[model samples]
Target: MRARLGGLPTFVLLVGAAYCLFPVAWVVVAATKSTGELFSTTTLSVGTSLLANLGELGSYRDGVFWRWMANSALYAGLGALLSAALSGVTGYALAKYSFRGRALIFNGLLAGVLVPAVVLAIPQYLLLSKVGLTDTYLSVLVPGVISPYGIYLARVYAAASVPEDVVEAARTDGASELRILTSVALPMMVPGLVTVFLFQFVSIWNNFMLPYIMLGDDGKFPVTLGLYTMLKQGNTTPALYTLVVTGALVSVLPLIALFLTLQRYWRIDLLSGAVKA
Candidate 1:
């Protein structure tokens, strides 16, 4: 009975993996095909036109696809970095300090987390429009900077990972609050901060609606919106289908590389014997 139960869990995991990976597998195969082969051949068959498709994609609209890619990298990288910093500071303050209205603020953040981002898009747009910031890079980037979920995670992780004893010891050493945070608390918080960075990066990278509403210039569109525009165009120009598939495949490579690079940070146990003599 034990062996059967163990096998069942393994079997379920295998199925789940396949379910997630199958579309990725199809996209890989689809990207390699030429426009004609894409529809004429079987869904999973590999084709010989990958290089041709890549060349066309590069030359299309004077290489706007690459621009879209650069925009995505900028938005995700910068937005996540700023969000992580803000969340770390805010979360650490909430975790370590006893202050007025802290509970009220944290509770408000919890409520923010419960609210769907989609619901805020219109209101955010209206607010930015009043300031004449809409249709600019700041429009998309600013909204993502204050992530309620990221703040919440940072708070939980700071409470668990950073010890009060270490903080008090730093105070005894006459370290300024900023110095203590920079030198002591932030180091131990690296793993959790990394998680926050990765989460916000992925969220901003994959986000569509906010950008769709905020950005009017095609030049400022991220990869997600760029590919979406191509998909829309594909309805009339069928040949763009191959390019869309290829773009989808290429778009995922950076995310995979990022995860592989950051996975090592997750294993660091900075809290282990952190206060040892």
Candidate 2:
């Protein structure tokens, strides 16, 4: 029974992997097909048009797809960076400091986490519109900079990772709070902050509704919104379907590259922490 139970988890994990990877596998296979072959061929079969599809995607609408990619990179990269910095500072403060209304503030953040972003989109749009910032890059970027979930993660991680004794010692040595945060606590919180950055990056990259509501210019649309437009257009011009598939495949590469690169840091940080502990 023990052996059977041990194998059960592995079976479940395999099933989960398949559930997640099957669609990705399908996209990979489908991207290789030409428009003519897309429906006629088997779902997983390879075709000859992968290069042609890529060339067409590049030339489509004066290469608007690449512009979408660049926009996504800007939004995700800058937004995640700002969010990580803010979350790290706020989280460290919440974890380390005692002050009036701290509990209330943290609880509010918790409440914010429970609230769906979809619910806030319209209000956010109205606020931006009041500032004449609607349909601009700032509109999409400003809201992503403050992630409640990221802040909560940072708070928890800071509490666990940063030792009070160490903080006290730094204070005793006459380091300012800012100095200590930058020089001490942040180093310890690198892994957690990396996690926060990655999460916020992926969230911003894949976000649809916020961009949909805020952006009027196709030129400023992120890859997600751009692909959505392409998918919509594909309904009328079916050949664009191949381009959409190819774009989807291409759009995913950056995220995959990011994960592969950052995962190394996560492992190193985690392993170093384990060794120290």
Candidate 3:
């Protein structure tokens, strides 16, 4: 009876999956088409021009596409790792210690989550400019490093995962607060930290607007912004559409590969560190 009842939900889910997969399927198919065939042929029909498209994209703007990819990886990889560690530290401190203005700080960070990225971006851009940091990597990265949502998640995980008794025990053992945090608390926050890392990684990788505003040089563009610029130029030169499509396909591959490779850590049972084998 349960299986039978699940059929409708499963059917609905499959429909949603198909809706999501359609565009990816279309991109894979469309990227293989020549400029003329892109619109001439049935939208999903595969063509023989995939190799040509890949080559064109590889050759575009003196191989600037690849440079954009590298910049994105650097930004996302370094930024996310740093954000995760910071989140872990902030979370641990908030969870373990109850002190003056604790509630105020926690509430402020929580309130930050409600603020849209766009709302603060311009102000951040202005402030970074004032500090002589604009149009550099730091301009884009600095604002992103302070992820309120990450801190919130980290706080929740730290509170639930690291027991106060264990913390007190560490303290009683004459463990310095920093030492206790580094060795004792951080190890326990592994699962949650991994979640934060992946979240920030995807967010940074997919970000368009911040990098768009901060970086003046095409050399500094992330894959999203780079691809968008390519697609925009494709308006005047139809042949470039193939390159843009191919670039999009290539860009998603790394994200897919990364997720597939380390996805075990993403099981993310924050409430319990134990993962099913």
Lowest summed lDDT across 10 adjacent residues in model 1 is found at 268-277
Candidate 3 residue lDDT tens string, 1-277: 8869889989999999999989889888988998888879988778989998888888887899999999889899899999999999998888778799988998898899888777777887788888888788777776667788788778878877888899889999999999999999999999889989988998999988898777777888889999898889888988888888888889998888888888886754443321210
lDDT of 2: 0.90
Write model 1 residue lDDT over 1-277, tens digit each, in one string: 9779989899999999999999989998898999999999998889999899989999999999999999999999999999999999998998889899998998998898777777888888898899999999989998889999888778877888899999999999999999989889988887889999999999999999999988989999999999999999999999999999999999999998998888875443334322231
User: Across residues 1-277, which tens digit of lDDT does each residue of candidate 2 receive?
Assistant: 8879879899999999999999889899889999999989988889998899999999999999999999999999999999999999998998889899998998898899787777899999888899899999989998999998888878878887999999999999999999999999999999899999999999999999999999999999999999999899888999999999999999999998998888854432324332332
Model 1 TM-score relative to the real fold: 0.92
| Candidate 2: stretches off by over 4 Å | 1-9, 264-277
Whole-model lDDT per candidate = 0.89, 0.90, 0.84
Clashes of each: 0, 0, 0
Q: TM-score of each candidate? A: 0.92, 0.92, 0.92
> If both were scored by lDDT, which would come out higher, candidate 1 or candidate 2?
2
Question: RMSD in angstroms, all models?
Answer: 3.8, 3.8, 3.6
Order candidates by TM-score, high to low: 1, 2, 3
Better of 1 and 3 by lDDT: 1
Query: Candidate order by lDDT, highest to lowest?
Result: 2, 1, 3
Q: Determine the backbone clash count of candidate 2.
A: 0
Which of the two, 1 or 3, has more TM-score? 1
